[model samples]
Target: MGSLLLLTRIGGRPAAFRAEDIGSIVELTEIAPVPRAPDFVAGLTGLRSRALTVIDSRKALALPGTPDPPDVRAPVVEVGGHAYALLVDRVDDVVAAEGEPTPPPATLGPAWARVACGMIETAAGPAVLIDVAALVAGPHRAAA
Candidate 1:
């Protein structure tokens, strides 16, 4: 079966997440820092009175640091019964996934390969589909 996908810019590269995996898309706001949190954890923000942990997409993808543009947004996604705000560069559009996703390319590198579920073709080109669970848990989780 196929599903809708939300295209987004993560670390200046195009990526996607299953639309069903997301709860809401919100504008970038003040995020309270969490002392001693992992580097990839962008910190925390609140939406509708609920606290949300924000994951820095660029850091998670091992990309060079770039300032968050004015339009940056966080897509609230739930995994393992907890919610996380994925701090992406921008939220593009929602599109219907054409077919089943194929395995991510080996050249995607370690950081991306760890969280990428697969790749799918979109009108804008191919986008690596992100695995929300792996992203939220992050790479260090396995070592801990």
Candidate 2:
């Protein structure tokens, strides 16, 4: 398949998610914190009358420092029937995949490698294709 990638910045590093995996991009104005939820969960926000569990991608990747504040843009996605808005540092352009995603390089760090489906080429450069399911699952998922 000729995949389309939505390039984004997570933890200040270039990343991509398959375009098909996103439901919509949304600008979150409010988020109510969920008690006892994992640290990666940024809380919940309503989207078109539906509630979305916002995930801080940086935290989900086990990156350092505090996550980007709410009122940030996110990509909405449904994983296992649950809706989620993944918080990203920046939402960049969509680009055509030059080829199928390939194995990420050895130099890839544990945090990114944990959720990386593969690396794909784009006009801008090679970006690790993020596995949305694994990302929403949290940073503890076993690396593939």
Candidate 3:
């Protein structure tokens, strides 16, 4: 079944995902920093009775860094086995796409293709669809 993915910004680019992938959406909050982990590791937080690793999406995508928010990006995540938080610029509401799926750019636009399903036109311009599993553990996503 098709689902709605809450939209967010990665590297200032528009992005989305299926609702199933999301555990929960919390406003920018504090994180307990991780030691010796990747710079992108924004740290961890508890959600739905589990700890999810918050990460800097821009850093993970190798984009230029932005100022650290006193209240950081919403940590929309997937947990259980694969756990990682995407630090987006901000988040919008979940959009349900209608009609056929639009294809992403032929070339894997950013190095984030594994996660990107492609761009689809909504009432609001074109939204990039993302595969949560791919985003977290695709061949493209670098190792920790």
**What C-alpha lDDT, on a 0 to 100 scale, does residue 61 get in candidate 2?**
84
What digit string (tens of lDDT, one per residue) describes model 3 on residues 55-102?
A: 766666667867445235474665457667676777767777654557
Off by over 4 Å in 1: 67-70, 141-144
* Cα displacement (Å) at residue 120, model 2: 0.6
lDDT of 2 by residue, 76-122 (tens): 99999999999888898988889988998878888888899999999
Candidate 2: regions farther than 4 A off: 66-71, 141-144
TM-score of each candidate structure, all chains considered together = 0.90, 0.91, 0.76
lDDT of 3 at 81: 75
Lowest summed lDDT over 10 consecutive residues: which window, candidate 1? Answer: 135-144
Candidate 1: what lDDT?
Answer: 0.83
Candidate 1 lDDT by residue in tens digits, 45-97: 88888888888877776678765553567789987777789878788999888
In model 3, which residue pairs have backbone atoms overlapping below 3 Å?
none
- The weakest ten consecutive residues by lDDT in model 3 span 133-142
Worst 10 residues of 2 by lDDT: 64-73
Note the Cα lDDT for every prediction shown. Answer: 0.83, 0.88, 0.66
**Can you give the lDDT of residue 42 in candidate 3?**
71
State the lDDT at 119 in candidate 2. 92
